[model samples]
Target: MVRQFVSSGSTFETQMGYSRAVVAGDWVFVSGTTGFDYSTMTISDDIGEQTRQAFANIAAALEQAGSRLDEVVRVTYVLPDGGLFEQCWPAMRDAFASARPAAMMIEAGLASPEMKIEIEVTALKGSAA
Candidate 1:
């Protein structure tokens, strides 16, 4: 199948020249997503809250790509502080309990200072075996 691009309607997408997610055949790759609420254009300082928002953003992108978090095959989280990881774990566990995708965490900087976490995911168009 031809590749399909998905958008989250965030200005950063247009500015950065990237799609929120792309679908190539049965695979869906969601771009790295920050916690800023595109609808409100705001970000939270709380790491846990940021983590939740990141997952929600990822879920939306997955849905647009004809997939869902439950179909995710991989997830990667980028955080500025390694110590903040535990705060983000429950959010991950809640979304990933069933999907249980391969996951990795990295310490990294983000686009903005208020942004606490960014998440990226890969999913299959169908359920994982």
Candidate 2:
């Protein structure tokens, strides 16, 4: 099987020794993505905005991996505060209303205090119709 790695141009990917997503055969596995804009390297304080940005980041990675958000088959969400999960629903629905992949949410501390949320996804290439 052929393998490919996708990057969002985030410095952390290189420093941390990981790709934003990896493609192997027909599967695309996206690493946990945060809200920090890759260009600006800045994150938002609002949970809703962060959630949207994280989806945007994930979408870009998926696109580069010959896949798309609608092809996602599984997703995992991590948040420093579980209470804020409710605030992310609107953005989540907007991003995955169609795919609605099997999902899980975990309440956990992130790499940094300012990091409010992280999301990871798995997609099958050409799975979306």
Candidate 3:
């Protein structure tokens, strides 16, 4: 199949010149997704809630790219505070309960202070890989 893009309808996708997810053949590469609730263009201050929202955002993009969370083959988590990883486990567990995609975490600065977490993932478009 030809390459395709999935848009989250976020203004950043235009301003930043990036898609929420890109589908190239059978693989879908999702961009780093933050906790911003696109509907309201706002984010939660709590790390746990932000983690959940980040996953929700990623899931939405994956769905648009003809994939689902359970099909995710790899996951990358970026956190501004390493200490908050524990706080994010429940949400992560809920999302990856079955698939348990290959995962990694890194401590890094994000775009803004309120943004605590960002998630990026790769999934097979037609099947779980």
The prediction achieving the highest TM-score against the true structure is 2
Model 1 pairs in collision: none
What TM-score does each of the candidates earn?
A: 0.95, 0.96, 0.95
Residue-wise C-alpha lDDT for candidate 1, range 66-123, written one tens digit per residue: 8999999998999888899999989988989899998899999988788888899999
Q: Per-residue alpha-carbon lDDT of model 3 for 1-129, expressed as tens digits?
A: 788999999888999999999999889999999889988878998999998999899998888887899898899999989998999999999988877888999999999899999999999765653
Alpha carbon lDDT at 87, candidate 1 = 93
Cα lDDT of model 2 by residue, 1-129, tens digit = 878999898778899999999999999999999998877878999999999999999999998888999999999999999998999999999998889899999999999988899999999988886
Sort the candidates on lDDT, descending order: 2, 3, 1
Q: TM-score of predicted model 1? A: 0.95
| lDDT (Cα, 0-100) at 27 in candidate 2 | 96
The lDDT for every candidate, in the order shown, is 0.89, 0.93, 0.90
* lDDT score for residue 88 of model 2: 94
Candidate 3 regions with alpha-carbon error over 4 angstroms: none
Candidate 1: misplaced stretches above 4 Å? none
